[model samples]
Target: MSKTPSLARRTKSFQASPTAALDAAAKRLAAEGHTVCNLASGEPDMEPVAAIREAAAKAAMGGYSKYTQVSGTLSLRQAVSRALLRDQGLSYQPDQIVVSAGAKQALFNAFSCLLDPDDEAILPAPYWVSYPEQIKLAGGRPVIVPADAAGGYKLTPEALSQALSPKSRLLVLNSPNNPSGAVYTDSELSALVEVALDHGLTIVSDEVYQQVLYPPARHVSPASLSAAAFSATVLISGVSKTYAMTGWRIGYLASPDPDLIRAAAALQSQTSGNPTAVAQRAAEVAWDLPPEATRHQLAAFTARRRLVLDALAEVTGTELVPPNGAFYGFLSIAGCLRRWREEAADAFCERLLAEDKVAVVPGSAFGAPDAIRFSFAVADDVLKEALVRLTQALRR
Candidate 1:
């Protein structure tokens, strides 16, 4: 008999994301009556502000549950255009925006539109969990450029210079980065942009966490730097992080290259059409949420971030750079790795959950096996309890 419907060769080397896997394990334990503190998923635990929910409900009642323009509703696309100008000093016509199911899909569309087989995409180490898989799925090779936690896990111009090649099609950059929470300064971004331009590299900038930055840190769009830079960058973003609308899945890709934008739209149209109509309407309202509405949530995260830092500071062995944005601590467990004589971060995580009942993502999933990611998106008491459990596990 023929081998049971063999999978494609492209998926042969794929690794399932440990973040989702750990989260499921935590949930399973919780379902089995074991108390579990989950820091595996990156989703904000809060609900969208009332205005957004109300708008979604109203839109649903008004018969907005139909398919939209495949890209987005004209009004929603125009709203995204306006939001870009208002917040990032970036300008784009509505036709240049392709909205998709989530920022994940938007990113996939970008890579699919840009990469042919064997093309290279420069990805900074300790990146978002999904980037490498998405690049591989698009038939591109991910050339990981390592960054150190000591330097805040940031990619420098020198690193970019070393990573680029004639076949390099793009560089994927996420400011207010996931896992690392490293927000690239304007100067840093400017230097990298220079190197990227010199190498003829397209920049896919992920800015989903732009709104959640704390003081002394700011979010700057690389596309806003200059005409050349803007022309070379495709911006990916969504209301998921800022508006606590992960379920809404309202995300878009904006580019000055109409051809790339068109290709993304065509690809999105063939795959996942317009995002949910009700969600699109709610996301449009999210753009108009009261400043205080989001500010209150950011205030909470600020407090929780402090809690994470303080907790880790008291624990020996594990260390982390204080994140300026995003709600995760990319904590180094090198000390614990040595003390426990552990090799793979994945094994350490499995032992951690099975023994201590605390769930944190293995940093190996983010391209750094010597670290683990602890999210501060849950309740204050939950975070407090999780830290105690984490400290206990490392000691074991």
Candidate 2:
């Protein structure tokens, strides 16, 4: 028999998403009759708001099954353009937007369009786990600059400047960042954008969690800083987080550069085509929904953040920086590692799952081996139980 063909070389460069893996493990345990508290995935447990659901059902019943423009429907793109102006104070024509399957695909499309062979994309840790992998898949190197827990895990402009090189082509800024939930202030983003401009690096600002902010912690888009910043930025966001519509899978990237947007659109066309038509219809309504539509989710996450921090305080050997936005808490388990004589965060997570039946992603997946990340998007009681179990695991 002929030998099986090897997978593509790019497959060797990155692993599957650790969050999805851990979530699957949690489900497996639950299926086995174990009481598992899944805090691994960042998906919000809330249902999509009434208007969005109504719009989707209306569209489906109306037979909105045909393909949309590869760049998304004109109406949906117009809605995205208006939303950008209203929320981030960024102006973009509908032609400048490319809606994709999700923010994940929009990011992939951007990287594919921006990176040539051996190009470098600067990423901060603990970043969303997919950033580095997506950059690598697009034939670019990920230049990681790690921020310490003392610094609130927010990357400094000095560190960003130091990471620059002749081959550096892109800088990714995820405000209300995942894993760490480090939301950069307006002034902070201005400094970082200045550094990127000085280096002539294009900025890919991921603002998916822009609406998930708590009071006293505002969300600022780097693209909104100035004309130069707007020109340098590819602003990415989606309805998934704010509208609790993760399964609907609608996201977009808006750029002032027509060439870049066109290239990304072409890449998207050859790959995923347009986002789902019914989902785009739903997302159109989602964009138009009042800010009050998601206020409850924000309120819930704020309370859950307090619970997580308080619980962590009681759990020995864990330190947190008090996330200001997003539904995640990235914890430094260095003390636990030392006390348990453990070296790998992944192993600790595995043991925690096997013993305490709580699931969380190891920070090793996000380029921070000394930490772990848990989502607070679960229901209040579920989150409370998870925190209690997490405390028990750490205390033992």
Candidate 3:
């Protein structure tokens, strides 16, 4: 008999992300007693809110161990709906919401529920590394529009208009974006909404980092701009980034369309079944908490952002665009490679890890070839140490 064949062709697009690879490498080096500073991971090192932890413990004791509705528990959905209304000024019914494993699964479910073989999804450059892979897994083509440092790594209305085609089914927008930390202003998002309206495109707004914005920067949800935009958009967000509940595995999607929510529910039922019951209960409490707790976490992240920006400034030849929000500094390291014979971004990162014991993600992973992403979600001293090592490595 012939040997068992491998999985389907789509698996090629699902390779482990460079950030994950770097994290694993850092872990291995640490296990071997090497002093490796990992700035490659996007996860914040902070703990979940106190109320969230207490709620989780209460739920575990209260026997919330059984399966909930495939979409989500009614209480969790209602909490999510109300949170969206309060925070984003977007209203939706409980039936129009679906809770999933995380924003990642919620996004995957959105694409799977909305896209087909011939559909196209437009993604802005310097996007989250998972966007294209998720699009491919849903059998949709990803049409990338490049964004440079000059534009704050954001997609303009003109760029969106040029990239949209008749076959375009969705436009994925991540405000306070992943690598660049570029936040979209209200006017900018309104212009993009007009483009989407004119072209009849569905907007998928990934606002997972909404609460982590810097003071001068604001996060504008496309769905909150207008009733039309709300009806045609799927707003994806979760507790992971906001409440520092990365291990909780709870995320939600809000849309005004019942059919889209139903489709996502059906897809999730056959795949993930349901988000954890205890997590759902815990998330409900998180959504119902006093605003002061969340404000404290935001304050901490804001301080960390400033600390990282200052540290990066000390390193010569590094050009930082001053990330307005999020805990990342997507820096241009092209000048650091001027003396290297092999000037590729990946080669630069590999050499830095080998010589300086610092792990950072190369920009090639995020569709920007001349930059690197430094996550400032770690403690201040660790961030400083990483920068020191990076400075030494580049100078060499």
Candidate 4:
């Protein structure tokens, strides 16, 4: 081969999102006329609320299709501020918010702005797969603090303290957690926040799954616990999960520190200048339509969660961390994978899909290789079939 210029040094160690990769592979198989039951998707099978869609359509037709402000429209930012206060009591101003293409982008911007080349960020595992990858992409090292079924996959104060080093600059908290569905309690969060403050670390609170939480599992914002935490934490959220508006691509980040918010906005301005104008309008509408408003979708998701719980109960040699919230069931394959324990998790995921045509994400992708994460975000019939297929395949 002729001598060629190289790809960016920044991408030397980057990993593509396994969640997206699995979702896409399932979609490809389905498109190829295969009878695959796709439980790999993290999105609910629902449409954006009618009001949200209508608002976006009206805005687009009213010549509001032009590029928006770099941070996002002031209207959307203000709406976000109001919603945060109304929902979480996270007292943030419109100017302190920066809307991005998605919550993923907001996370990327925050990490990029905060991390130095060799700084360390604490990632409580089995975190969302993107957390570590995003940390790596920001030129920061991800120091994963692994949690297991015993702790419900949540980080304890001791774990947080042990993971800290002088180079630790940030901690990423995702709850109601993806894969694990662990919602951190206010007391738990307060302890973690205290540890973070002592370590002089910033907390990136990803609250995207907050709305999907089921009964008895409360959502607590760390930033709301104390004035210090409020100052130390950056909030990330979007309208995707709550309103089923994933394609809308409207997300925002908020922080009381103007300088940090400004820094992230500066980075976002050069990248995706703004989230879509129509999407921003739609997000504004979505912010007002609480998750309770979608009674049908909520009921369906609750039923799906219960269905998975019941199915897993019959599957011995497996343990599911009682999911307090979110639409995923993170089942430990440790007791079950008697033979596969000697092999890689990816192998089983592939073999299961190839043989049984049931798609689920390998747990290794989430920094927990002894299990798998299944999104219960599908129709009732589809979910039942998928669970049946999973049980049948695992029995082998």
Best by TM-score: 2
Q: Judged by lDDT, which candidate is best?
A: 2
lDDT of 3 at 75: 88
Model 4, span 1-396: residue lDDT tens: 898888997667878888888889888888989988899878889997689989989999999989988899888898999899899877888999999999999999999999999899999999898888888888899999999898889999999999999899999999899989999988888899999998899999999988887888889988899899989999999988888888889888899888988899889878888888988898998887765677777788898899999999878768998788889999988766775564446777888788888889999999998888999988788889998889887777
Q: For residues 1-396, write the lDDT of model 1, one tens digit per residue.
A: 677887998678787877888889899999999989998888888899888999999999998878889999988989898888888888899899989999999999999999999999999999998999999989999999989988899999998888888889999999999989999999999999999988889999999999989899999988988899999999999999899898889999999788998899899888888888999999998876656778878988999998888877866787789998888989888887888787757788888789888999888889999999988988788888998888777766
Error of 3 at 158 (Å): 1.0
lDDT-best of 1 and 3: 1
Between candidates 3 and 4, name the one with more favorable TM-score: 4
Error of 3 at 262 (Å): 0.6
**RMSD per prediction, one decimal?**
1.6, 1.2, 1.7, 1.6
What's the count of clashing pairs in each model shown? Answer: 0, 0, 0, 0
Can you tell me which runs of candidate 2 are displaced by over 4 Å?
Answer: 1-5
lDDT ranking, best first: 2, 1, 4, 3
Model 3 misplacement above 4 A: 1-5, 339-343
Candidate 3 CA-lDDT value: 0.87
Residue-level lDDT tens digits of model 3 in 337-356 = 66464565798888778878
Give one digit per residue, the lDDT tens place, for model 2 in 212-288.
98779999998888899889999999988999999999999999899998899888888888899999999999998
The collision pairs in model 2 are: none
